[model samples]
Target chain A: MRITSQTTSDGVSEHLFTLDDIPGVIWSPSEGTAGRPLVLLGHGGGQHKKAEGLVARAHRYVKDCGFAVAAIDAPGHGDRPKVERHERLVADIRQRVTQGEALGSHIARYNVALAEQAVPEWQATLDALRELDHVGGPVGYWGASMGGAIGVPLVAAEPRITAAVLGLTGHESLTEAARRITVPVEFLLQWDDEMVPRDAGLALFDAFASREKTLHANPGRHAGVPAFELDSSARFFARHLLEDGGPAEVEESSARLDRS
Target chain B: MRITSQTTSDGVSEHLFTLDDIPGVIWSPSEGTAGRPLVLLGHGGGQHKKAEGLVARAHRYVKDCGFAVAAIDAPGHGDRPKVERHERLVADIRQRVTQGEALGSHIARYNVALAEQAVPEWQATLDALRELDHVGGPVGYWGASMGGAIGVPLVAAEPRITAAVLGLTGHESLTEAARRITVPVEFLLQWDDEMVPRDAGLALFDAFASREKTLHANPGRHAGVPAFELDSSARFFARHLLEDGGPAEVEESSARLDRS
Candidate 1:
């Protein structure tokens, strides 16, 4: 692991790391710990490790919940090398739009390929993080859209992940991945997502084998996912991974959302 | 500069080259040239230097036109580390789609940013290639979409280039770049390009200061461009770069296209 750049903010530190070709950012809480839980965050497709949502959530996990957070770019995303097929896909989609054709199969193929390619990479990243001294602790996950697509299969296979917050994505096939995930989960859903059907999101949520799972459905399009939901998710990981937070913290967050 | 990989087919040799993180592939004819003219080809957005379109053109220039061909991935593309903003832009587009909004601004931004950042990198690759003994000769440029966006500014400023094939992209604001380009040009335009307005493309062509310029309008959307177009582009480069193919050859190709 190499630290290419580091930024310190209000006692929290953001360290940019590169191992082989994998580029990632690690955010450590102000109150550091040797065995504190870590949040394995992820960015949506076409996003890098430091996307606004991922960074905001990482900060919330670190500052509000005292959990260390980290994320890496998915394949053909972020600082990683651009894949040629992705470029081909971009051109095809652009051409299709010009022809006024619906992007049904190409979009589906793009989503499936990106998510499938990223799962093993996420696992490799988990292994790399675990070897670091500060990361020797429990882990959770937070991802949306393409990130959610990847997280489902990842959380299913990665036993080290104790919990996950996934949303803004759904394909019936993804339910199979969700069914294998036994970790505590908090799934977000936009009532009128233009890209992902509501039923697909619900189906994945329903498929989760975890005894502790909750679906937070809000009114809005895909981009309309409420901001407060991130706060609740931060609390969710805090309850599962942190020493201080538990059922009381989780219940309080639900109440706050109810009031909002 | 290093040759990381090499493959031979029939009498042609495809060699992958890398220099300080810039990854490219060079295609050579059966009978190599010590100081052969080299075509600096570029790939479209989301593509690496070895994009199929680019590879096909490179091979055509090498095997068919008898000129050495080379291409380097643009910045934030191929083997180079991606820019952080590109990742953010991608996420923003995905989120926007979920909201069922037009991607006018985001797509425009993505195209602009990728092109602007690529110009300097293209210049550097040219400089690096010039130092190699096998690459000592006149150079030409071939690019489309994001490739053309970068090529306009590059050809406008880089006097080393004698000719260029630029098209499939246009923004009125880019005319300023076109205005400075005085090299011989073969500009291709897809009549019904979905991404670039037809007027923008024509306007950019009109802005070009080149005394020797021709517009090749084809029937099709962006991807509907005919394969014969690439052949013409190769012949254009050969007419300008290869000593054997000169004014007579250029006139012959103009006649060939006229009849077709």
Candidate 2:
């Protein structure tokens, strides 16, 4: 991984990094985070890792909770190489819209194909992140919309993630992924979403095998998610991940390495 | 549909039914049956309705249990028109075999694509079957392997189906369909299957939302499904579907009418 640039202000540090492949941003407690909890934040559809909301969430985790946060662009969603399938999906979606069909199931099918690629890429990125001493910490996942769908399978397949914040996604029964995830979960759903159906989102929540999961539902449209939901999510992750500082004694010798 | 030919033997009648589009066979108790149950049977990969095993199962359900049984060829299996996707899947499987890779996930993806089309066709067939006066009864589904995968979604979508026998199919995690299936399910898993991994099959069974589900696992390869499992399936359907028949009083006028 290459650290493209870093800016330190007050008690938080924002760093932009690219590994010749995965380009992402990492936020750390500027006072010096040796080995702290790492939260992987996932972005929604048509959004990038450094979206304003995600960046704010990262700052909340690092600056407020003394944790390190990172976000990577999922395949075809951000600064990644474009694939034909993504273009095809967009074209198909446009055609379907022209034909006046609801886009939920079509979008779900397309996302399933994309998530199949994104999950493994996230796994690889996680594996790579472990090489950085300061970033080696208990990992938690936070994502919604496309992020939730991708994170569901990612967390299910990767055991390192201990908890998750999933919501704002409407239903496409992905119980296969949800049933395999046993970590504590905080799921958020917009009850009156214009996009995803409420039943499908709840179905996804019901699929999670987590013994402890709280559903955060708001009576707003898809984009009208209540701000309190994020606060609840922050509290959820802090409760689960703030228990221990992993290998805090590990040296920060390679923490600031700049590959470029 | 046209009843191409009919023959009575041992107090049971076998009829070859054909439409210009769909070809299938129907077997029933020959004792002037009009109030018996109807069971839709699906054959495994590359097998036809008249395959020896399917035929035996049909006879078991028809003669032994006094239920009407029917089976139709899937879009590209049996005598139906071949789809390009099916050929591509076969080629992909062949290539994977040449490269010595695992087949379970690969097969699952291919079958998922095929089942997306198969389920709607099965729904149409079910709609047509309801028009047949002598064939109207408590509906049950019996399918194994690829048949199981297709039937899972079919039975889930068609609420008219009261019970199902699904087995030998392993992990494509079509949990969307499985979750919607609330009927009693008899799922069979081959413990030592060479093609599908055991977990995939069990995962498929686990994905089912049925409150009443019995899993029958045998220590055998894919085709090594125990002979008596069919008997168990026959009994399961009998228990669920042998009750009061549905709309059996409708006229037989459309029973033999071929749309072609």
Candidate 3:
């Protein structure tokens, strides 16, 4: 879809946006209440958002479950600067390898920078949402493959993120990124995948200490996400991000809880 | 090294060669008293001959154990057709893929063509090799990753190949091609690799019902082939392809075999 800036709910305002310079389409649901919760989506390696089945499934979850979603490209992927031309991106990656930085630490720093840049772009979108008087404040994140790789650090660093779902990605230090994720997390794996081995995927899952964590595995390949698993991922984000009858419910309940 | 033609003491006498068309150096060891056995070395994905430790080790076995070696490039890989326009390559790939062909199968066809094309160019080189008197006959084959994928079909179809070492690449079927390979085989795998998952590799190995066979697994990633595995792989081919040895020695040898 064409990336452009526009406002909804009577067009009282406008937002800034751009086409994913990468190879995928990012779709923001047109039907969410003002102040609704926001969920961000990321894509995998050699794949744009449109290529990853999980990202599209995630959009469904946010839309039907009553949340706004923001899908963006990962570094050296999607619309972000090409890994070859972006010296900072390359140097950052080199530093991680040369210094022997923990996988988690390296991923955290890279993801934070990715989010820092994209989050502002998202802010304008969120601002438009906030102006609509329907969107919520609690933001969530989701990704698969390289997208999942970026999702981890983004959620961990951004305390505002309420929950996350990562698929076909997440493993122990790839080169040197040790995964130390704290946000509520969910992981999905393919039992007989050739692109990414199952053991590595499991090791990444085990490293996380999140009490609200889940692992899902199904028969598939590196090429596509299974349909059943996608449904499960949607259910997960719904439980944490969309429950409470939308932002109005949270706003109303917080007042009562604060009074009590 | 530049690609050139070469002939050997093998009864076949003349064979083409091209060091410039492929990524690594080519060495033609002197033939034994009898016709020298030929061993072709294949490389893994995103890698050339020198990148994988096993390729060099295999070369050593060919040298010390009396076997001839020819290391060639897969399509779109190494030095062959290096200056071709991207559009031409993509169109060729699309044409192949549209015909319901795997990238490897097309690559195998391309490699065979290159081999045939190099024949005229390699005549002088072959004459020099014959003067040096190395390699008694046609050629045997071995490869990992893309090399392995190409080797599977090539060995099965080409009668000149007496045996093969199929490293990290294999799949159940390749387009319209299906046949039992008559030659002896050996397969290698990395237990924790994220690329070319172990299962797909194993399936390819199983498809080859070689009465004489060996399987080895080491701790590493897609690019992590240890220096020692080559010795084992070479030993495998040596037993089956070398004139002095046979299946009986393979079964008796203590090569630290891992069936899984």
All candidates: TM-score: 0.47, 0.47, 0.37
Model 1 chain B: weakest 10-residue lDDT segment is B251-260
Q: How well does candidate 2 score on lDDT at residue A10?
A: 60
Evaluated against the true chain A, what TM-score does chain A of model 3 have? 0.64
In angstroms, give how far residue B119 of model 2 lies from its true place: 55
**Model 3 chain A: worst 10 consecutive residues (lDDT sum):** A8-17
Worst 10 residues of 2 chain B by lDDT: B251-260
Error of 1 at A121 (Å): 1.4
What lDDT score is found at residue B114 in candidate 3?
Answer: 37
lDDT string for model 3 (B92-158, tens) is 8679777876564444444444334333323333333334345556556777666665666666666
Q: List model 1 lDDT by residue over A91-126, tens digit each.
A: 787798889886545665676777777888888877
Tell me the deviation in Å of residue A171 in model 1. 0.6
Clashes of 2: 2
Q: lDDT of all the models against the reference?
A: 0.75, 0.74, 0.52
Model 3 has how many clashing residue pairs?
Answer: 35
Candidate 2, B1-260: lDDT as tens digits? 78789998765688887755777888887765575678999888888878998888887677545688888888787778888988899899989999999888788888888888878777777776667767777899999888988888899889889999888886646767787888988787765688877667757776777766656655557897755456446546756776622211110111111110
Evaluate residue B175 in candidate 2 and report its C-alpha lDDT on the 0 to 100 scale: 69
